[model samples]
Each structure stands twice: as structure tokens, then as C-alpha cells.
Target: MEYSFGPLIDENSKILILGSLPGVRSLAEARYYAHPQNKFWKIIYGAWGKTPDADFDARYRFILGHGLALWDVVKCAEREGSADGSIRNETPNDIPALLAAHPNIRRIIFNGGFAFAKYKKYFGAPAIDYRKVLSTSPACAGRDREREEMWMEALGRSL
Candidate 1:
């Protein structure tokens, strides 16, 4: 059973970015989007016309400073590999409780189809603004312009 990391969030956070769960590399490193190929940090930094720092702690601070928070939909799950298709017997995170506790969270941006689907399955439609952006995983293939535009639209515009 693979477990997700604790949420990188605080009372100042306005946008909650949710993924399905961490992949092998991220789990190994105990960080979000730790896979070198993942485009999460790239897209986020691009939103502010900056570059991601080499250090994970710096990146975490950057996200927090931007009023963004990160977490996963699945608290724990049995899965044979990183592919979303392999996920099963999943236990969901207490998203509703989190939302209630953090009333400043005005939007939820699912990091991919899997995260969005899982959120719907567990919490139904949330009372706040929510949308699904393209996955930043390397599994999605080809770091293309469309991905940039989509992610920029979701996170680049405003907090």
C-alpha cells in the first residue's frame, strides 16, 4: 500500500491542486512531482514568469507564497505501478473536512482526469469553483504547447 504525503497547505491558500496520488519517484523522494520528467513545477513557475529552484523546499515556499496548495485525492491505495489504471482498493482523503477547515480555499484544480474522477466519486461536485487540468506526468507524453496553455489558463491567470 502506497500512502500520500500530507497536504502542503495553510490558511492563506486559495487554490487547492489535487492529484490522484504520488508516483514511484515522488514517493521515494517524499515530495510532490519529484519525477524529473514531470512538468508540474515547470508549469507553475511559468505562470509567474520564473523558474523552479533546484531545491524542493524552495519550490514548496514558492507554491505557498502564490496562495496555492497541493495534495492527492487518494490517501492510500493498492496499486501495482504508477499508472492510474492500476489503482484499486483506494481510500479517499478527507477533502470535505479540509475544505470546511480552510474556508479560504475558493477553487479546486484537479491535476488530471484521474484526480477529477476520484474527487467526483468521493465528494460529488464541490460547492466551490473546480476544474480539471491536464496531467503533468511524463505518462501523458510530449511536453506540448497545448498543455502549457491549459495549465496557464488554470493557474496563470489569477489566484
Candidate 2:
């Protein structure tokens, strides 16, 4: 079983961004969106009017400082590869408990279709509103600017 990293959350976090699962690169680096080609950090930095940080710790701090929580929909899963399509025998994260713990979290944003679908399947419709954004993974086909715009729109709406 592949285990996901713990959530990057705090009491003040108002937005929760959930991905389907950590990819191989992220797991190896013990950081979210660690894959070199992934645009997750760039999109976030653009939304926040900040530049992407080269250092993992700085990037993580930047995310948390902005009151954004990061985590994955799956807690554990068996899969042949990093692709969400390869995921199977999955155990979902305890999102309800997370919500309870972070009452300030008013918006939950799924990072892609896979994250949204898995979340809906495992937890049903959440009490709070949610938005589904395009995946930031390099595997997904889209222009970075276009995807960033979509993410910004969703994040703006939630805020």
C-alpha cells in the first residue's frame, strides 16, 4: 500500500485543496507536488501574487501562510504507477474529521476530476461548498496559464 503524507493544515486555514493521491515524485521527496513538471506550486503562487519557491520548506510555508490546506483524497492505495487511473484498493482520507477539526475551512477544492470523483464516492457531497479545478500534474494536457486561470477563478469564488 502507498501511504499519503499528512495534511498541511492549521486552525486558520480556510481553503482546503485536495489531490487524488501523491505521485511517485512527491512521495520520494516527502513533499506535495514535488514533481518537477507539476504546475501546482506555480498556479498557487500566481494566485497569491508570489513567485514559486525553489526550496520545499519555503513553498510549504508559503501555502500555509496563505491559509490554504493541502492534502490528498486517498490515504492509502494500491497502484502500479503514479497515474490516478492506476489507483485501486484505496482507502480514503477521513475528511469529515478534518472538517470537524478545522472549522474555519469553508471551501474544499478538488485538484482534478479524479480527486473530485473519489471524494464524492467516498464522502458524498460535503456540507460545505466545493470547486473542482483541473489537475496541475504534468500528465494532464493543458496550457499552464489556462489552468492557472481556472484555478484562480475557482479560488476567487471560494474566497
Top TM-score model:
1
Q: How does candidate 1 fare on TM-score? A: 0.97
Candidate 2 lDDT over residue span 24-135, tens digit each: 9889889899998998998899886888989989988888888899999999999887999999999999989999999999999899999999998988987897888889
Model 1 scores a C-alpha lDDT of 0.91
Find the 10 residues in a row with the least total lDDT in model 2: 141-150
Maximum-lDDT candidate: 1
lDDT of 1 by residue, 30-61 (tens): 99999999999999998999999999999999
In model 1, what is the error at residue 105, expressed in angstroms? Answer: 0.6
